[model samples]
Target: MVVPAMQLASKIPDMSVQLWSSALLRDLNKACGNAIDAHEAAQMHQNFSQQLLQDHIEACSLPEHNLITWTDGPPPVQFQAQNGPNTSLASLL
Candidate 1:
């Protein structure tokens, strides 16, 4: 016997932040009961969801579309070693 093809369906939000934050904490529209632009709403979202932001960053993790900044710092200790036994895998080979 042959089985028929199986299909799956689900609903998704229009914005990524919706997936990032909760409907209760994130207004996105008129956050804090005032009309606001996207940046303003983003600030409001941050204000309302800083705690959730930490939780969300740790839990669900933010998508890499944009807005997140990464700072460059000194390399790891292993990289600082010039000719140590295990200086780095690249130099080893």
Candidate 2:
């Protein structure tokens, strides 16, 4: 079943933000086939809903427009060893 863009947006505001500058939601509705089940559709809606909220929170809490500037300094010297084994994947995973 296809969900309306406004209906989905009203249900998930974060989707509104992500779709605020794009037409991703409209495209999804168009491409989604009728074979999709209710459970799958609900799951997809929930996932997008959470993502929307997360994005909204991030946007609201960001310091981009504030007086402070967010920055990422260089990694610690110990973690930058060039001769050591490549454990980047291990650490990240």
Candidate 3:
């Protein structure tokens, strides 16, 4: 089923942050030998959700259509892997 971008945007805020955080934490733990914690998971989830929202907005080709306002202005700089394999989400943020 094809979902409208605006519709998805409307629903994005309702998406379960806990579920996404838990799932992402699980994967990260497995990859990094259980280095990720609950708090870090939450931050990662926030960053991830924002990026998804931004991407959806761009795809819709209507930046002004967002239902919410970002008082912080532009989104956070996405994490880049330059510090080698020891880097953690918390450290990146």
Candidate 4:
């Protein structure tokens, strides 16, 4: 995904390269598991770091760089009990 974004960022003017890289890093971190082998973990971290470095370089090259804006989506809606009196646990047993 970072590779595609890097290519696209090159072609598109005013693209937020760092923002895309940051998102990719976040995803990679989330996907990493504690149970993964040491070799695999090292390899994954190295790849991510390299990509981040490349993105930083690309972003720095831009003439007019703007801070990336992050917007939080709407909060999840809470469900309310529509019908009725709560059943006692003892009654169910």
- Candidate with top lDDT is 3
**TM-score (all chains, Cα) for each model:** 0.19, 0.35, 0.32, 0.32
The whole-model C-alpha lDDT of candidate 4 against the native structure comes to 0.47
On a 0 to 1 TM-score scale, where does candidate 3 land against the true structure? 0.32
lDDT against the true structure, each candidate:
0.38, 0.49, 0.49, 0.47
lDDT of 2: 0.49
Scored by lDDT, model 3 comes in at 0.49
Each prediction's Cα RMSD?
Answer: 13.9, 11.5, 19.6, 19.8
Q: Which of candidates 1 and 2 reaches a greater TM-score? A: 2
lDDT of 2 by residue, 1-93 (tens): 245544554464456553442244444544664334344455555666677788778876754333244244432222334777644323643
Tens-digit lDDT string for candidate 4 (1-93): 444544453454433554454445445545664333334334544655576678788986753242133134432222334596654323433
Model 3 ranges off by over 4 Å: 1-36, 62-93
Ranking by lDDT: 3, 2, 4, 1
Best by TM-score: 2
* Candidate 4 stretches greater than 4 Å from native: 1-36, 66-93
Q: How many Å off is the CA of 89 in candidate 1?
A: 54
Can you tell me which runs of candidate 2 are displaced by over 4 Å? 1-14, 17-36, 65-93
Q: How well does candidate 1 match the true structure, expressed as C-alpha RMSD?
A: 13.9
